[model samples]
Target: MTALQAATRETFWTIGPVGKAAFYWLAAVAVLAFGYGVYARFAAYARGREDPRDRLSNLPGRVVSATRTVLSNENQFDGDLYAGVMHTFVLWGFLVLLVATTILGIDIDVYRPLAGESFWVGDFYLVYQFAVDAFGLLFVVGVGMAMFRRYRERDGRLWGKHTSLEDDAFVWTLFLLGVGGFVLQAIGIVGQPARADEAVSFVGMAMAAGFEAAGLTTAGAEAIYGVVWWSHSLLAFAFIAWIPYAKPFHMISSFANVVARDETAGARLPNVPADLDHTNAESLDDFTWKELMDGDACTKCGRCTDACPADTVGRNLDPRDVILDLKAYRESVVDDPVAGRRDSGVATDGGVDGSATVSDGGTVPIVADEGGVIASESMESCMSCMACMDACPVDIEHLTSFTRMNRQLVDEGAVDSNLQDVFQDVMTKGNTFGESQSKRGDWADDLEFEVDDARETEVEYLWYVGDYPSFDDRNKKVARSLARLFEEADVEFGILFDDEKNDGNDVRRIGEEFLYLELAGHHVETFADCEFETIVCTDPHSYNTMRNEYPEVDFAEFADDPMMPFDREEPWNADGETDVLHWTQVVEELVDDGRLGLSGNELDYTVTYHDPCHLGRYNDEYEAPRELIRATGADLHEMPRSRSDSFCCGGGGGGLWAEHDEEVKPSEERLREALEDTDAGDGIEKFVVACPMCTTMFEDGRKTGGFEEDVEIVDVAELLIEAMEAGS
Candidate 1:
């Protein structure tokens, strides 16, 4: 076939010469405008304080992760199927259209000039036309669904009084741009002379037929085509230019945020560099650049807020609002960090000024409640349960800013009376309750076999009985039960007696990093004198902090770090360097090996397991407790929100000590969930918990929940011990 005939075989843009040139001009202006917005957003981020997160050390791995996140959208889909599908279609549709546009640009500017004919023709061109047209229609459908959810149906998750005008504009821009493109295509199909052959796009053909059925003539179609084509082109270019200025800026920022996400576990908070008594983030300049960038990446999806226990239980803490307000505050401030340093009469050495205190002097409130970034009351309301971080698709660390701000609050001596008491107790007595250190091992007094003191004798497992299990009366029973199980399994475990103190898990979460460091350092000193192979704890909080967070602490200088039978390179295995096991894991291991002998007992109660936040989300240890429950011969029933999605018992992050409004406490809310009909529509009789905090919170919740002796909360170890004794 001739080159001209081949180019003409499959139809192309019928917008004529003048209109085509005008469209190109609009696209050029759109490109420049989009660039300007991007540059401005990045420049604002650059003004944020220094954070060492800029290294980009693992470039290849980060790129792979970013690409996977962009392509999958799995995080969003995993949470809400409807939202996920809609977002995926819109994202992939936009990506496909972008590719098509690039090809078209090449065909028109390079291929046509070089070969005297466009590259897209025949069967290939037909497939290209069909795919682009189909994806465009899909994009419109997705946008329409989103528009309905945003405006008409008003899904509570998407719409709120706090929803911004920029958000509305973002959705409307894409919705209109999509609708206009489809209408323009329909008009083009009808106005073309080869309408019969060019009606390859079924969607465009159907739309054109509808237009024709309404008494549309060829002349009318042609005139309408020109106007619709121009409108669609203008809308496309304008939407592109408006992207960085709208909520849609997340398209760019979310990708960067994912690439820049901290690779540590979700619960690991960065160590504060400055002296705790001296400084913390008191302004936008005090926040790390990456933290400031997180504000730009937020899509205002409300997933984090919806999952937040504090928010769910009627606390003033909303993760989405906290991040959004921070971004807004940053934007409201000057772009240049030192722009008016001398002019405003603020010392360049960083000290307090009127209304705006410099970060160095620690006088300014970091993430000030008065400035509306995050309210001080809201900060207290947080449980540090990690639900917000788990729910966030864009990887916004809501706790980072809150924790830093909280550190400042602590440094300024502006804590609540209850927290003050708890902090003082931890400092003075090495526990939150201010109990005597000598009584730490009193819980195991009833056990038939003796638990060796690690300081006096070598043992296999050094049991780190956390604050609750060691001091609280109810949790002390759990500790005794666990000790009996260890005796039954013939495990050589010992405690530090009066020497063991709090492991500083909750202390660290409460934003007292230096105090935690001191406590942890003391433990390192104690461990150096003891000869033990593994460390086991009854509390998930201690297990998580010791296993994950403690390694970051340098203990090499502390008496050459007492030699271990295991290697550090292979962590937590039977012969691994430093093994730290939760008691549930130890019990499960004992059961699995036929050592505890649970095969003889039959636990008849219909029970459900409550996953502690530290165990399930922080350390990903959900199955061990359940497995141990099954070994007890109990008919295990699962809660609707079990495992990683488990509801907090309201005791993590110092919530055990912090006073909360009784009417809206997270523990009561979770207890109500436990009392509700199970997923199988059967009521659970007993609530089995793994962590000490879970046990304490639920025990209190049982008293407050007003249940008629229908449900009882017990520790998993307690249940196991009961089974073991019954079997014996």
Candidate 2:
């Protein structure tokens, strides 16, 4: 080799071993840091004592769906966006920095033998330097924005206390640590000048000129580099160890939780398990670990709390807090097995007293103490509206957990006396009214058509005349109108009549899962024996339970029962069941089929439609009812919160039976919105409803709000039936 080449080789050889040792040490530190992070994560999973299968099932799909949802612009919540942007940037920056650090460790330690000798080494070094500088800047900026948002945003301030001082300090400390590391590395690059033609680290090159101008000597620059690198390494290590104990732990835990989330649409209710016998199992004594883990998946987004009418009107409940309680309770169970053991009667090391005042119904009514994680009021105040489940981004079935707890209390006769009477009525007569089965067919009297058999005969459609439609005087008109519409269209339909049992949808929603299953089981059996092709019910609760909940029945032999099709894709109608019409749909179908006609001149008054929570949000059947109304050409007005965002009528989830302490009733609030829309220059004087529950709530609201004198409420089906008669 030439003299110059030999000298260059010697120069490289001299710097190589020192660089190799530095990288090796960095690699060792990184491996230890990563190892600690993994261990901590696994320890948390173990601590939570969750079912592994629950986490594993549908996880990949959930992750994919959440990613798509985040990226999409559809129906974005403004508050969520503000929070998401701050979180996403910080998360991405952290990821990039993490990767760069890992590579830096490997380059310094494992690949030091090849460094300075290979062309690839220079290229990789430049890339690593660029990545670190870019992500570090992003991290600093993102953290700054988050700090500002926490301290300055009006909404954030209004929501209560912002970020704690300790969290702010930790964030700023992290930012400074990252910045200092980069600055030191940049200074070191400036001290040791690379050839102009060589692959240069952009950040390193920029800093080199600054350092040269500042007149820092090579020895001084190296010393600064060593200090900064050491600080960065130590801080990184500390972050790994601190993750599990800090709020930042959500960074990892949230991702895991999101990935393992359920994949159903937010509006659909979860399936009620049919394993426990509602008739015999007196209390919540039958709950399994799977039932408990169902509660652990909550993300605590507060959407449920925001959506809850009870919370809005100053009720003591917060659905988000309820789910949090379940999580805390599950964690307590894990920490102290004795706390969950039925036979145990002493406090465990985990501080949970086994001898807490548990009701005969299996309800643990312990006061909020250091050892007890849940309170009685926390469980009782739930309205069972399924609002929490709807609002949950992860689709955690909060209502089911609440129902399980209620089942424990109700079965053991531990609930309030008023509720006990309702349960007894349900048990005795297969209906909440405690009326005889023979009385169920009373509404069918005076009708011009024959009531075909719902159970013993084959029919295109089996009209499941729900209890309210069958027994309630006001709702009977709705049933009669629906029957007339079907007859006009020549639709081959029959009624279950006295044979049809209560579907108990509200019972389940109100947390009477055991009673709900008993009712559901009988209904399922009745459907099977009747051999009905399609069961059409006006009640959304019945539709939801039959379609969604019954499938979870544990009996494998009954899994594919004709009543509950495994694949929900099959139509719930006869050969031409073009629509499983809400009575509104049937009326609309009759109009569309030319069997029924509406006279444009019959109804001169303007009308508005109140979208029921179930028909609108749960079933997505908003258009048919509105179309039926518009077919009459009545002036149609809409409330501000209509369609999927419609407020509940305050009668859902057995709210009709439970007398609420009238602070600001949900129905009154919804009615006020409707009243406001009526005066919106449309001159609407009537509010058209499709659900019986909505009708009941609005009528009550009308009386309470003193709007009965000026406005009127009518069923959507009744309007179409009226229009048909006008034309006839």
Candidate 3:
């Protein structure tokens, strides 16, 4: 016979009857596995009441964003290289292996057909073998590194608390499963005596030699091959089944989560519906399924927790844990609908053996039971900084969810007595101070300009003077300065004066969703009668609420004016359309427009700016405020945590009113960072802040840190106005 014909015959012989049978069996198994996976996946979705299809239609855009995030080192730590490399390798290797597996399952000879007649199938086989082996090695190495980081490495700030034994065990099990699957495959390939020419399978050959030396005959070798193959298949199946119950569930959910990722960083909280009349909804209890599922999609990545001022300062509240608790509560409600029902008053065993009975009504305790799950303290720990919601990858409206639950507890007479008083104050006083509503416009009286009551007349801008800026004595300076900046800029702006109501951004963030909606609705109504082209505010919280949240009011046609004109519109270009601007931002624009001027002052003090959680992180207004500061010719010293990564002031989320343990005061920590940044021999004369809450915190922190006389806490608006006046 010819050499070519002989080679052809040998190739066919290698893939003889037994090989064909084995291939068909593998195909059947794959088909069944895929079918089962689809069923289980669908079932899980149905259980969660989540749609099986992509809710966000922008798949291509999402893919691009995800790719950018993975490639960028912006948010990730420098020490994550080893884990990052391993993760990337595993992801890419799995993708290639999946393609190869698909080809094998189809019974298509990829090496023979795709490579052409002259192409050596052996070479292709070697390539596949090497890839799998290399990937297997990487998978083992990566998993080991992750395990070490979780266990051996005592990095507290990055990893936070140590992982539980259960989590550690799961990680090791997954690692072993991967290693065994590859090792088994390698051994089975090498066990075939006729496959000796497949030189690329070096690992397999080594494994086969070990098996042979262990006294395995040809029949034994074949039996071992079948056993290993079955073991590998079962492990794969088990991994799939266990996915939903484990953190690895992110494998399936992360893709969808990324696709549905919010375009805006959620730094600005979304408004509750204002036009309640347009909807069939009657009360706050009538939340849609979408609203209900907001908390469930959290991956608990701790991005929010890391950014949270409260968490940074040692507050008991971890944003990630808060979302997890809400998710758990939601799951519990599903498991037993009667669990959350206050009317039932039926007590379950509290999931503990002879623990204290938790009644549906009356006061709920602040501390968790022995299991460390349910506690009012957990709810109170949140500062409503919106840092968690901003940093969340899954767009979990954690602040909103917590607020809703808090409201439910409070309404049902389940909250602490102190909290009840605070809520009552918020409800009656229009501010948490519990002062009369008539005091809302007291700050305006100190200003020289005529503060227009926009309630009766048409205005270019409706200034939302929030509770803090109006009532707080220190914050009153910010209010007065903003008014002066407006006058200097020649901008046609007016405040609601006494008519201004609470925007509810703070209250809602604090878990008082009901009060927030009500307050926001009233503000929306007050503005409905007024003709205004733009809504501007010094407070980022109020800005976020009026711009995003007030739209939830039920009245649709009452305020027919466009919220803000598009810059592209003719009228906007012609008349210079009014846009919402922070006081500092407006001052900066005026300086640029030559309406305002800065004085030449040798303000040689190096100043560090503290980003208000809402202003810098949420609203992306970091630059404007910084620019305003830089205009004063002060050396701008940036904190390690700045812009989107800025830490909270420990005064948000109603934390200003809530009591905190001395050990975990966020203000002290923030002040330390600011002080550290300005650690020159001369010392920082001024620590500039934009948000009123931040101003308050820094002032308190300065006093606490015993630097009250050394370092002065001042607002950016105050600085800008001062600079302009000095130049004048």
Candidate 4:
């Protein structure tokens, strides 16, 4: 009573010797089952190809970063605040409770049994007891939030066709694991031999006091406590065993996926180091082990689908379903990866022998028009905007998996007629519309000064005018305005003129792999002959490819060719990959440096900005355009879906090349949003866009959208130009 510094409990208190033995037996069985399920997943991974990106070069750093990310619950908070708060509480609460349980197990099994000393007592014991009690309540609250979000309030992000009976089971099990633990503790407290130290367990003490107040006599409490204790124990055991089989598999896969995820995944894509032509493979066997595991890692939370531009309107693609289907297929073929590892000729890089049939080992087709796990329609319907990737908490690279399937579709000539025509145009004329290569620089003809041809002269900037801005009349106007801005700023820039091609951005996304290679290779060769420091782009699509994807391409084979056009010793910027900057970025730089001189161009125009998916989400360059907008003295109002959640303009990933069948294309929906957001008491009826594709799609949206008559789509450069003139 005076100095009660030491406090602990028997591991199996009051449970008979036989009951203790039975508990150990159940624990052993649960551990074995959990171990087998986890091992089977790795066994499944062993069947896929090597992922070059899975380098362990910075193992310690990766572990530290992954640990910090997992512990902080940062990824979960990216877009949805409710989910973020809900998940943070659950994650931290569950982790604290888990750690407490582990310490108790270690104290009982290892520390006390082997060392004859306990680290499970005194201040540590009191603190541990308090933490478990507090976090147990927190865990229950989290489970309550999740259950309400899943069933009561029904969050759209937490529901879809992929949501199943197991989802309900996973949540209910977690609920019991938390709430039941507390109930068991309360009943145990009411009946157990009590001491002064027990008061530190505030929740249990309070519940025990309540039980006593309710006349829970020791005899009756003892009778009820045993059942509650055993039920809780069995539930925890089942929870452990079911982790790998149910939604809880995300606990393992999601963390690994996050740690291994490429920071620049959708933008740079995976650069498989083999003959990455994985077309002959029709099943999970074609996907790398990491990619196949991406399916398993998915939480089936439907967040990706919630963020999908394709799904936002009315498209056949559902990213959540795509991953779930892949996960189901992977479970079916878990044996195939294992068999392939045991001398079945599964290549190290996930490529298989062209002659070997994947189906021979139970792996089946993933994408097909008739019978497949992922419908061909879903794959094609994807805009490849990477909105799903940005939205995914687990870092599932949906685009990476979809890109592989799209390549297979291309191999089979499964592309639609509209896309096929564009591919042919890109192949023959080096532009999307089969436009003459000579006209690539026509947009600059009317500029105050001619943009120097990079082939003929050295320049500080090599502008990749891009296909749309160069070919499409509306965007060409934006191109000229940007060119005028560049000239006004005295920026030394040149372009390839006719030598410029489509840059193979959309071509790559459209699944014309070799064609993209061919087009990009042509530019690499031409750049070798030119002299420039940076490749400037007006199209975020082009900027994304050239800045991110192009350097990852293996041009050693192409560049080493004996007779490249305009023969050069090395590819452009051999000293380094040439810096790629979008015009808005460059314009911002110019304005910052006092190059684009202006004073009091304060046109108090309140305009909302449309963030292009590539610029905002893919590159995370949300502010560059916004800064330029403010530079023009416009008050920037953001749409509900701005920045990372920016609605797609329905012009990315070959969407511009194909017909949009939906009654309201994403571009149209986006326009409607812009109009609503900007209608604040006669706010300016113009919306600003930064990318060429955005301009193209939004211009069309302004033509056919519901508020077409009420709004105008202006490029960020055009608005800036308007401001400059206003100052003049």
Most accurate candidate by TM-score: 4
Summed backbone clashes in each candidate are 2, 6, 19, 4
Off by more than 4 A, model 3: 1-83, 108-138, 154-166, 181-231, 262-304, 325-345, 351-373, 393-395, 415-426, 436-439, 444-449, 452-459, 556-578, 599-602, 677-682
Sort order, lDDT high to low: 4, 1, 3, 2
Model 4, runs deviating above 4 Å: 1-3, 114-119, 153-155, 272-281, 335-364, 558-577, 600-602, 678-682
**Whole-structure CA lDDT of model 3:** 0.60
Q: Write the per-residue lDDT of candidate 1 for residues 1-728, one digit (tens) a residue.
A: 74323432323355787876787788899999999999988887777667644536688899898889878988888669988888888988788888988887888889889999766876667677788888887888888777877786666767554586888788888888777767777777777656546545778778888988987767788777666767777888888898888787899999988888875534667666533234665555667778888888988888988898887888767777777766655554454454322233333222111223234322223344453345677778888888888888888877777787777777767777888888888888988879999888888887777789999999999999988888999988988888888888889989998887888888777778767766776776677788988899888988887887776654333323343211133112223376888888877878989998779346887888889999988888888998988888888878778787888999877788888764566777777777674763336778889988888888787777675376888888889888877787
Q: Would you list the rank order by TM-score, best first?
A: 4, 1, 3, 2
Over 73-103, each residue of candidate 3 has an lDDT whose tens digit, in order, gives 2223333465466556555555555665665
Window of ten residues with lowest summed lDDT in model 1: 564-573
| Best candidate according to lDDT | 4
- lDDT (C-alpha) at residue 135 in model 4: 88
The TM-scores, one per candidate, come to 0.91, 0.76, 0.77, 0.93
RMSD of 3: 6.9
